[model samples]
Target: MEKIFTLAELVEEYGTEVQKESFENNGNLNRRSFDSIIKRVEQDWESVKEEGRGSKRKIKCSGKLEDKAMKKDGRVRSGRQQVEHRIPMDVIVATHLEYDMTQQASMSLGKWAVEFGLITELEYDLLRSRHSSKLRQKHIDKAIQSGTLEEDQTKLLDEFTQHCLEIYGQLVKTLEHMEKCGIILFYENWMAYGKDGKVSINPEIMKKILKARRELMKKHEVVEFNLTAHRNAKKVKNFNREWKETLAEVKDENGNKLGIKYYWKEYAVILKASSKAVQRYLETYCVDSLEVYVNDKDLFINENVADYELKRKVNIMKKAEKRHKQKLQEYKEQKISFATAEDEEWIRFFYTQQELEDIVAGYDLGVKRLHLQNLYMERMGQLFELYNIKGYNNKKHLEGVS
Candidate 1:
């Protein structure tokens, strides 16, 4: 029997005053990153221990990742000292996984994962078991009970009883096609601890990831961050910063000319606003009417003014129309070219478009087929970016990846 060392045991055996400090700045074992990674590892180890299966990996020290322990006398103490180490503190242990026992452990975890709602059963079967099986009656009943799926669409999918049927079914073939075509299709899930705790990546999960994934995870094995600071950064990028400028004449109390007021405001807000916004703004300002200036002249003028003073909106409309067409053309060109290229790529990769469509059609076990399609699209999009970037943003997937 192979003996597995608890992290703390390893630390006590190998750590000295200088080992942790000496490896602190070393590229492979960054101290700060390791500090956080170890905290997560300990927590995961504890969770497994608490659930009674932690025997796969014993815990050297157990504590919540976020808080320090308070003694019975109410004094706080450091939880992680010397003997309680997390990986990247030691390179050899961090990257190691037991090959013989990992698969069974992973299947147990995968089943537990489904029971806890981390991933759908179909996803677990495809990713973990890869064996022929029938669609769980639970999923089918739930989909119907949810009522989002149309009866007709649900019926169409229901007819494909062999999709996951026990008799060497359609699912295996579909999955084979998906894998061969480099079409990334998998459910997203993580067994996360409390609000501030870490996501547990079981040895089983790691084995699969290591088997096929890039070197990033292995290279940075000890620095895994469950929550990234950059996850939502792009949402606010350039937000409300795009501005537009227009000129409007301001009249004096006596209706004399007041030179143009150069107005500037957010372009997106203005473009997206409905006509009702104009009335709302007028009410807020306690003004009876406000003239809109488009391009160089006033777009709205009362009959009290000269007919010639009423600037026709034709010029403004022309500009809007031109902009609309340009945007549409760009979208069309990019979309058509990308779709064609992707289709070709699928064929070249040995998975036909018809097979993909059939696979999707088989999975449409609900009325909300669009929602189901979106999940696949999102997964595929991630795969497209990842593989394409490895090829240095190859010309094929650039305009079409989105």
Candidate 2:
């Protein structure tokens, strides 16, 4: 069995000078702040010991303890096992925010921490700003050290350019065809508005057109990709000024202009739909009939298929909304922690079926709280699709009857 140190012993051994300064007033080494940290560290240690060194559970320690352990064998020891030391905290203070930032998928742990009342908004903002700057500096140092700073920048620019090109190709054709047919495009889900005897492009294309248009408008605003601006050229005004203007002055060995600057205007002109008619046409299409194609087969040509898909989405949305509202009420009652609908959507987007199943199956080693089951069940509900709820109900009834 591993030894667990008491709060007093831990404060005596590992509390930083600043923490010790508060000792005279608080008497328990600022126990309010450190309590969660102590629990987190103990949880991590227990997880590592039970799961072994190969576990993804990060083993954290106080910097002073880690330094002492490193001196012994150039590695940190957790009880009888050697574990990798990632972040070092001095009595699990605000420094632990860095670990959360690293572990969080979206790097927005600070916001969530504040939302959960683990930290005050002021503390969250300050810590986020401070850590973000450190992360930026660290990125710069690593990029410079790898000698791939320029290469990475150019690659990113190229990828952005390609994305713009793809967007232009798709949107220009779809919008033009819609205009020719006098069809109006709506930004909302097609089934919501278009199912009532309306003709327009599907919701997917509508999203692409909107996103592509935004990217086109933002082309010049992208500072790093503005080659002329980087060179401090005199004709910066001409750069991304119009559809006719070239993007950059760079030329290849053959004197052919190079980079996104060369074809920037052309891409923008075609993609941006700058003409008032096209812009309005993008916002509103007036066509009464439309056909959707998938793999050269008309999808909506078979009304059954379109109906099936629409019905599927409607069922999904109904179930998701019901479950989400229930979870929200549960959260209000303090029976469970709840994620917002947007967060649940992200969970649906990012988590695979197997991953979600693993989480729901009590196999999520990292999160063992009682409310976690309730939370993940909500996520599973979000991902569930019931195209035939009536059929399912009948089957369930038969099974229950048996």
Which 10 successive residues of model 2 have the least lDDT summed?
82-91
The sequence of per-residue lDDT tens digits that candidate 2 reaches over residues 1-402 is 344455444555556666555654566544354643454344223221222121122223432211111112112223212111111111011112212322322223333333222333333322322223333333334333433333223222222222222222323343334333223221222211122232233445445444553565465454333431132333333333542232233233455443322111111111222233322221222111122222222332244333433443453445445644664454444422238988767787877654665455432232222124444333223222211122233333223323
lDDT, residue 353, candidate 1: 49
Q: What does candidate 1's lDDT look like per residue over 55-144, in tens digits? A: 133434443223211111111112111111111111111111111112222223334333322234444433321221132333334334
- Which TM-score value belongs to model 2? 0.19
Candidate maximizing lDDT: 2
Clashes of each: 5, 11
The candidate scoring highest on TM-score is 2
